[model samples]
Target chain A: MEMTVAEALVECLERENVEVVFGYPGGAVLPLYDALYHSTRIRHVLVRHEQGGVHAADGYARVSGKVGVCIATSGPGATNLVTGIANAYMDSVPLVLFTGQVPTIQIGTDAFQEVDITGITLPITKHNCLLKDPSKLAIVVKNAFHIASTGRPGPVLIDIPKDVAQARISFKYPSTVRLRGYKPTYKGHPAKINEIAKLIGKAKRPIIYAGGGVLASNASEELLKFAEAISAPVTNTFMGLAGFPGDHPLFLGMLGLHGTRYANLAITECDLLIGLGARFDDRVVMNITSFAPHATVVHIDIDPAEIGKVIATNVPLVGDVKLILKELLPLIEKVDRSEWLERIKSLKAQYPLSYNRDSGLKPQFIIEQLWNCTKGDAVIVTDVGQHQMWVAQYYHFKKPRTLVSSGGLGCMGFGLPASVGAALAAHPGCKVVLVTGDGSIQMTIQELATMMEQGLSVKIILFNNSALGMVRQLQQYYCQGRHMATHFQFHPDFEILAKAYGIPAYTFRTEEDVIKGLPEVLESPGPAFVNCIIPPEENVLPMVPIGKGISETIECE
Target chain B: MEKHTLSVLVENSPGVLTRVAGLFARRGFNIDSLAVGRTDRDDVSRMTIVVEGDKPLIEQVTKQLHKLIDVIKISNITEDEYVDRELVMIKVAAEPSQRVEIMHIAGIFRARVVDLGSKTMTFECTGNEGKINAFEESLRPYGIKELVRTGKIAMLRGSKFVALSLAQAREAESA
Candidate 1:
């Protein structure tokens, strides 16, 4: 059937089973929004800001395991999506963003509301398209989703010119995308897999370093089996948090710069480091020469480029982590490494996680309490900064894909919208908990409206310290406590904001109040907000200052 | 430690070179030399990298290269019998007295003097590694101050293999 490019876009989205779209309309996107008005199957949520729209879509994508869709007008609207797009790009979330541009004739004329969004977002997106021809809209839309959701998933942007959206074209959504340049390796070479298995058998003390790919690939079960079979202790990066059960005897807490003492010590002491779906990012490996000092690293990832980028590896397997683990599982023998396990146990006991109980409303304590109440089944999303690191260190996730947070970019204001997405995607009756800081929550506080509009029933626990706690801590350590812009004197009452958004809200100042109020908040029906006022001096511990080795961690004073 | 020719497919985007080179520099991996060019697909480019490392380390390096989002595919093609060539452009200050001698040396290397000014002559040369090295060494004494050399761009001599035709392999898998 002949249809406008804008109408074809909506039809394409419907073909992909997208029920909701998050966006704000403007001059350049008028044609697309006009088409959207006639569509009954797809619901559009108008956001307060373009950033909110992109983040809301990102949240939806993360939770649904589908490409999250967002649309915006040209110029500032497209530029506003940059930060959110970069956030998704860093975290490897699958998002398809649509931005309207001025007509093709006036592209370089700098017409009103015209911006080169594709050029601006080039670095932040996996791939992008600029559709000047109306005929290419359907194919480009289909290709954008395919690129965004496939292999190492990330955001993809499609900029549709205003005139093209108004032009008529025959619509047909392509069932599959065929791009000559983009081919992802999915299966590992059999010989390489066999070599890895042989290395596993020969290694005396092997440590498995799991990353975000474990959860992305849904390889947690296979990872656990491989660890169990080889008697290897598992450690995770921040993005990989919750990929393995923290309570598992063979599992060590997250490792690297801000990782636990036992986890870092284990990586340092192990003779073999088996990396699964984990890139050796600079945050994890402080000194290339010194990281895994005594180990021969066996790196396995779908992306071949990550294998020896940071730390030299002895064995490299390029394929899906789950697939590689499946092949390696049967070839491995189960052996009890009592000595290594004993050393790890002793280390864990000596440096056990601890915090002062004097404060009545401690963020760490509340996170633990929430974990206990939820039994680690609730999907926990966190904002960036001090609270993010604390939640990483304190919260013990017992299941894979339970903890969702910004790891690569450490983007602030990630929790609320992401929580909403998780709630929307949750198995009916599952709860989505958002652990955010006062500063981080305010950055995207407008997402509260999205939660209410969607009726997502997310529980947001805000750690209100009246300061940018992470920056404050950094100032204390590095800047001799100048305190400059870290403190915020005046702030709106979160309860009032929540009420304005038509969601139940509460505030607790004392530890006793938090203990009593947290459970009540979690049990509430629709979207609820709990603002817990924590002490400003609370600092996340076991920090490795930049350029310092993992062993040189500074514990909380 | 053996030298290997690594063929890398990278997205045709800016700063990819910086990312790839920075990765190698940070890891302290010594790269002998490198070459890059546009592939048949405008969106994708090819990079030919030469590095000396152990077999295990080379494998590890290729895997790490794959981790880079800009890098599409990486294959070690050092084992194949291929043709490798480099182009070098050298500008030497010829004192009118040394012009004939410089031309003589250029002729022996099959180099062409692309530009000639009153006091200086620019020679463009293309050859294998040893030939380029010999030409550079002979011109060094003639006041050769500045030189630009394009690193080795290699292709297999026979029509037995082509990386770009992986569509057939993909089709086989789907079938």
Candidate 2:
């Protein structure tokens, strides 16, 4: 079957079962867009910016369990996707990005819209290719998908030259990919798994520190079973928010810089620390020497490089978490862990995640109200900052892939566009709520038009602090409160901004207003926005300042 | 820190070298010396990297290198019985009076005079790090004008091999 490379590319996408692609077109991608024009299988979403398109694809991948695909044109269009690509890479989201390139003959001549995108993205991407030969397009696409979605998934880029897209080729999607250098270990070493089982059996106070890898490997159920079999309390990393049931007794909320105090205390005192698909990030292990000092660390991750990269591990299991957990679960011997459970209970009671109830229209209260209104069922997405921490603290997620936020990258402008993708990928009638700060939302507010255009059911919860709350908090602690560029001297009315985008908008100045307006806004049809006026002085508490251990968290006074 | 020599087998593809080099630069892993060339297989290339790190750090470097999609296998051959060699060329000023002494020194090291200019003599030498350093030192008193050296290349002793089958077999046995 002879076809143009662009047409073959579309066929390859169909073969991969890609249902949707978020992209912005440009001159360099004209031929590819023409091919997409004739395709009926894959839906093409035109985002307001290339960054939004990539983020939308990221959200789509996280929610759908598929390799998210995004497309951009040459130079500026490709550059616009850089932040989003880095965001996906840091979070280990499986994404395939296609960028248009100048024609092959003009590649190095500094032709219009020609950039060394492959070189620019080399350090960031897991793998990348610049397509010079049209005959290899199908294989490149196949390889890109395989590399992006496989073990320890990350982003991959395929830059197709304009001429190559226009070139004709015989299309044959390879049934099986054979890369001699790219094999991933999917099963754990039996000896190592046995060692982990023995370690779990011997330990008295064991804690399971779960992260995004658990969710990536679809091991949430196994995580629950492993915890129950070992009777270990599970504390989630920021990315691991929905990996365990938030309502479960063993659940210790999130443990990190702004983690729950009980979770942090449990980490400090636990006898054994079982890290499940979780990298002990700096935020999680604030002081490496003091972090889980008495605990014997057993780090189980698919990526071999991550083991012992930061925190030293006593036993390392390098393989799929779900498979390893299944093997280890059978070997687990449930012990009487009432003493540790009792400690956890007391710690939880003593340092509960609380805020001032007397304060009006608090961001944390809004997240809690949204949780109540949605019944802990909505797919909550959030941008980075105070509101992001608030969502992690307040939203009690009961399901996996329900809380989609930028954990590793902490990209500020991620919420609105990502929610657009999440809403589309979510199950029909499932509400996709975006909790964003005023400063963060404005960074990519243009995506609101994209959301309205798609008629997505995303309820926007904008926490209007009129300042960058996280930075201000940091300044108060670290900069002697010399707040410069932290406060937004001129701020827009988000309600009017949302309304201008044709999204039904409301503003709540009081807690009573939120109590009355939030449920109605969430229950209403199509897309809507609610701007809650929050106090600028509010801060995300229980913060473990840098150089301090998790045990040294400062609780809300 | 101790010096560790690693033999890495990678696919011969565009930007694969960049991928390897970029990884080292970004990860802050210090490379003492590096040399890349074609292997017995046309599609595969071998890179001999001499890096400075402690035991745990070397283990980390090997593991991180293995994460690259193009990197097939890596062997830290520092502990193994291996033969290492580096080729160095020195261009030194040789007056009519110093010719005999320079040639005598070259002959002692088994180095050959590859090129002769009007005011300089270039000697090509191949040896281990000790021999190469000695060769440079002996030529230094002769007013050496320029010098170049190929980074270290090494091979395991006797029947030991750094082949794909051997790596796969080891992995299989461990599994």
* Highest DockQ model number: 2
Report the C-alpha lDDT of model 1 over A1-557, residue by residue, as the tens digit.
99999999889999988988889999889999999999999988877788888877877776667888999999999999998999998888889999999989998898988887876776678877678768878777877887788788889898988899999998877777766445778888899888888877778888999998887788989988888888889999998988899878988888887788888888889999999889988888876766888998889887766766667778888788898888888888766687888888998887776778775677888878887789887788888988888888888888876777888888898777777667666778878888899999999888888778776888888899999999998898889999989999999988998899888889988878877888888887877888888999888878778777787777755
Give TM per candidate.
0.85, 0.98
The fnat scores of all predictions, in order, read 0.12, 0.51
Quality class of the docking in candidate 1, CAPRI style: incorrect
TM-score value, chain A, candidate 1: 0.97
Candidate 2 lDDT, tens digit per residue, A1-557? 99999999999999999999999999999999999999999999999999999999999999888999999999999999999999999999999999999999998999998889999998778888899879888878888899999999999999999999999999898877766677889899999998988888889899999999999999999999888888899999999999999989999999989999999999999999999899999989999988998999999999999999997899988999999999888888778888999999999998999888776677888888888887688899999999999989988998999988898898999998999889889999888989898899989999988888887878988888889999999999999899989899898877778889888988899878988998898889988888888999998998998799889988888
TM-score of every candidate's chain A = 0.97, 0.99
Cα lDDT listed for each candidate: 0.83, 0.90
Q: What is the interface RMSD of each candidate, in Å?
A: 7.6, 7.4
